[model samples]
Target chain A: MAEILARTVEVTRKYGDVTALDQVSLDIRAGEVVGLLGPNGAGKSTLVNLFAGLRKPTSGRVELLGGSPTDPARRRGIGVTPQETGLPPTLRVGECADFVAAHFPDPVGRGELLDRFGLGDLAKRQIGGLSGGQKRRLAVALAFIGRPRLVFLDEPTTGLDVEARRTLWDGIRRFHAEGGTVVLTSHYLEEIEALAERVVVIGGGRVLTDDTMDAVRGLVGIRRVTLTASGLPELTGVLGVEQEGTRTHLLTADSDALVRELVLSGAPFADLEIRPTSLEEAFLTITGRESQAA
Target chain B: MSLVLTHARYQFLETVRVPIAVIGSAFFPAMAMLFFVVPFAGDNAVASTYATGSMVIFAVMSACLFTYGIGVAEDRAQPWDPYLRTLPAGPVPRFTGRIITVMGLTLIAIIPVLVIAAVLTEATVTVPQLLLGLGAILVGSLPFTLMGLSIGYTFSSKAAIVIAQVVFFPTAVGGGLLTGDPAYAPEFIKIVSPYLPTRGAVELVWAATTDFTPNPLALIMLAVWVVVFAALAVWAYRRDEGRRFT
Candidate 1:
């Protein structure tokens, strides 16, 4: 069994009258990547901050590495990349890592980190001079500098190009492969779909759903399937049937039985394929939040 | 302590690197003392006293106002506070580091200004008296430094600059540095002035130049100001720490 690295129970945070997080609980295990998904003002950032010990919950307890979250030793084992790129603009990439690394007992070498992030050429350049993508990469590099056992990445790939995002995804996978736990928050559904083994959906300061990607999609249910035939075969139990482009698309929870029926009917169909409902559709159906572009 | 020193060194370098702040706080005051005080070389003992006093206040103001005010804002703009808080040594070291850097920078500015004032105004004071004046000036600046800390933490960057100016000019004027009208100043002003950092600085310089003793009442008042301002700074810092992640 994987070790439980971080856990929170009934966590609630309030800023005066505004509730940022309410009764949120989560468990993250070693060597696993958990995606935290939410719309704007959905308490995603608040949850990440509480886990990182950057913010304290008003009414909950958090444990990091089996110790109090506030302990500096526990914090050293967890790295956080905040939503805002909190880098010193004037400091060079190398200097930024060096400064943060100074706090740790045995940090990874600067050259290794830069090389891993493909920032070798930009090491000597000031952060202000870096492009947005480069700055984002630098923040990610800094997060891993301490060789932390658990990492919290808040929108880690916000400004990256497609290739850079892929590179980061690979790096996260590598980190998890080495038995490091990662909690990631991203607006990109595909990023979560590709990375996270288990996903947690938050909305309005509360958790709407927490399950594996397949389970979440299952909750939304497969899109109803429809098939067309010339003889007008009896299809009484079908969920819904729609005609389009001179053929019928069957809408049903069971695609296999419908396809078997169509094959038995011997319909002159040119195209047929199984289509799974996307996580985005599932997210919209479950949370009822505004539909976001995939 | 070492961690605090590290932060202090960084703060010191950052302050010195800013050209506008360096010129305003250190360079301009030295120039002002040279051009204004040097030309009128005569038996004008009162003008000489005022010049010497004002130069010291100028140094303290530069340290407490420009350095801490701007430095704290810039530090907050980045992840410095969170980063520092994550360190093993905690926030006390960071605060100490800043205080040490401020004190060092104040001394650097004050010494040169004092030398220029002495040469230009032909002010006479022995080495022992000068050392005593330096001690008084260092002690007197604590309240103002704490005041600057409170201002830096309490306001946004733009508001901090405005607040610094608002505090700077009145303190300079009411403390008998610019106007030299302690008598004509209001009774409340006279009573409050001697307790201000500028007032303590001025008293130190005045005593050094004229071989006079400082009033025990002034020292007590300065001490009170230091304690109150220090409390305000701590309160502001704790409140800021709570909201940093927001």
Candidate 2:
């Protein structure tokens, strides 16, 4: 069996009245690229931060390299690129790489690291002078400086252009080819579809689904329910809810139970529309026996 | 050692590349020496020597406060800061490295002030006393360094800048840096100066270079400030970490 690189056991993180991550457990074994898929405020970053040892769980254990998440020694085999980092504006690109490289026992050479990230040309330029894409590339490149066994990238390509995003995909592929484990979070499902073999989907601080990339896509056939309601009521059997202006788009696989419960709640309401057409396509695709459900 | 030097080296390169930063910290003490002490005190050996001591204290204070206080706050806002904090080495290597860089820059920063004092004034000190004065300047600077740490950790970049200024000016004026002679110190300052660390800091500098006798109360207050600020710095660090990451 492959060794586990990092995992959280029944982890729940709370920030005062808000529970960011519910009782969530995840295991990342070596040589696997696991994509954490979630929308905004979905506890994806919280779990990633736990695995990276940046935060402690309120009621559970987070382990890295079979040791305490807080222990610095456990970080020897790990690397992380947070969602945003302001590089020292004055340091040269090469110098920034070298400064981080100095912390490791056997670091990749500065020149080679720059080459690996396609940052060779910008090596001598100060970080303040680099463009946004270049800065993002550099931030991601620093994670691989120590040849870490596992890397956690939080929204690594949120702002990169298509070409730059592809370039980064190539870099990630090369690392995976060398037998490195990667766990990354992203809002873009296409990014996950392109890069991940396995995936974890989070919503409302809970792991809604965890499976292989193909399996995860095949896991749910959700009906998008749109409703005009004055306020949110206690929800039951609803997958998730998205609020925009005066309308709410609700996602669920079971709409009959959801609609019954919504009507029973006795809240002030108006125009109500339930989307079963999209679900018909998904439900058919999942059942394997083709039917003209749409 | 190499790790520490590596951090220090980059920090040095970063600061020096911005000429304004060097000019900004180095200018005030030298200007004070030029405008405040050169004409009035240059004719007398005792007066000029003590004045130079006060200015030296001023230079060290500026370096430590801005370098650690504002520098740490600025770094706190950076992605690189959290990345470094997460490394297996913890924060010791980087912290030591930054401190070393600050010490080095502080040394280089005061050279202009010392040069002006040497050429334009009759500030005379034996080689041993000068070395001791330099040593005392660094030692007495600990409280201000801690104060800067607290301020940096407690505030954002813009807020840090404002808070540092608000702390810097009053402490300088209240502690006796702007006033050349302690004997000629104003009444309000005389009462409150002994309670401020800067007053204690300048006294130690003066004592190191001249026949000045520092008040026992000033030294005690310096110690109190050091302990309090040190605690506050650590608290601010923990508070930042808890609020942002954990």
Candidate 3:
């Protein structure tokens, strides 16, 4: 059992009559990458702010490293990349990283962190001159410069191109592999699916689901299965099924059972394939409908 | 302590980068003193008095208004406020840092301003009185600094600028900048002027040249205003904190 790096208990924040975050509680363990998936205004930013100690919860408690988030010692072990682009525009990329590094007692070498993030060439360039994706990359590099045990990244790859996004995704996976815990909130479900081991879906200031990536996908059921067969066996218990000529395509949670039943039915099949449900389908199933109504 | 020093160093460096602040603090006062030398060269009384008084008052205004007002406003404009709050040092160290920077800048500017004022305007003052005036000017500026901070926190940039202008110029004029004779002013003006920051500064400056003494009640009133503005600033900060997380 890994130690919990961050935890929240019934934390609620209200702005006058409006509740930005309702009684929300979550636990993120060490060396784990938890993806926070939600639409805009799903209280994801609010939760990140709470964990960062940028704002105190109106009710309940939040703990980072088993202490108040405001504790300097606790904060030293935590890194954050906010949703808003926070690097000073006038500062150079290296200067911005140095400024954040100064906050920690011991920080990783500037050259090493910059090189890891593919920002070594742009180190001396002013932040104002960088493209949006470059700035975001710089922000991520700064967040990791401290070598913090836990990191909170909110929309970390918002402005990145496809290639840059993949590069960041690889960096995040490597960070998690190195035993650093990361809690990330992003609109890119594919990115989350690629990097995060667990997905925590939030909507309207509430957690819709928190489970492993495979479990979350299972909740939405497998999308499609293609098999060439003379006659399709009955799939009454299966979720959805379709047949065309000698080919049968079925959507079911139990693809193995369906395949076995087809084999037992003595159907001639040339190609057999089962496509697992993606994180996008699961996210849509959980949050898409409610967000549309809201 | 290191955190406070670091913040103060950054703040002071930032202020020095501003051309307006540099001109207003160091240049304007020196220019004002130059006028005293030309217009009242023969009369030592007016020239000496105006030289020391105007220079000191200007220095105080620069620290209180430019340093605290503009500095606080810019800090609020940045993500620094939230960033600082999240840090272990918290707002207290950051606020203390700004005050330390303001005081240091004010002290450093005073030396050159007074030296230039004395040399150009042939201003003369006793060593004891000069030291006393320095203490008085620093203390008197507190209320205005607090007021600037209150305005900085309570209002947006446009509103704060308008209010600062509306209050600063009129108060500077009516509080004995153009005229040394407080008795010559209207009764209501005299009563109101005494409580203004300009009046405290002028009185402190006047105390350096002649045998004039500051009104104890007026100083008390200024102190009361400082307390009030400080309270208001604290309240505004708390309200802003509540809004941020909420």
Tell me the docking grade of candidate 3. incorrect
DockQ of 2: 0.53
B19-54, model 3: which lDDT tens digit per residue? 577556666556655564435542565545654675
Chain A TM-scores, per candidate, are: 0.77, 0.77, 0.76
**Taking the tens digit of each residue's C-alpha lDDT, what string does model 1 give over A86-117?**
66666677877787777778899999999999
Candidate 3 residue-wise lDDT at A203? 76
Give the TM-scores of the predictions, in the order they appear: 0.80, 0.84, 0.77
Candidate 3 chain A minimal-lDDT segment of 10 residues? A277-286
Best by DockQ: 2
Interface RMSD of 2: 2.0
Model 1 alpha-carbon drift over 4 Å, by segment:
A82-85, A217-285, A289-294, B31-50, B77-89, B125-135, B179-190, B204-210, B244-246
Query: Which tens-of-lDDT digit does each residue in A192-211 have in candidate 2?
Result: 88889998877767776689
Candidate 1: which pairs clash?
Answer: A224-A251, A224-A252, A225-A250, A225-A251, A225-A252, A226-A249, A226-A250, A226-A251
Which ten contiguous residues of candidate 2 chain A have the minimum total lDDT?
A: A285-294
DockQ rank order: 2, 1, 3
Q: How many residue pairs clash (N, CA or C atoms closer than 3 angstroms) in each of the candidate models, in the order given?
A: 8, 2, 0
- Candidate 1 chain A least-lDDT 10 residues: A285-294
Error of 2 at A33 (Å): 1.1
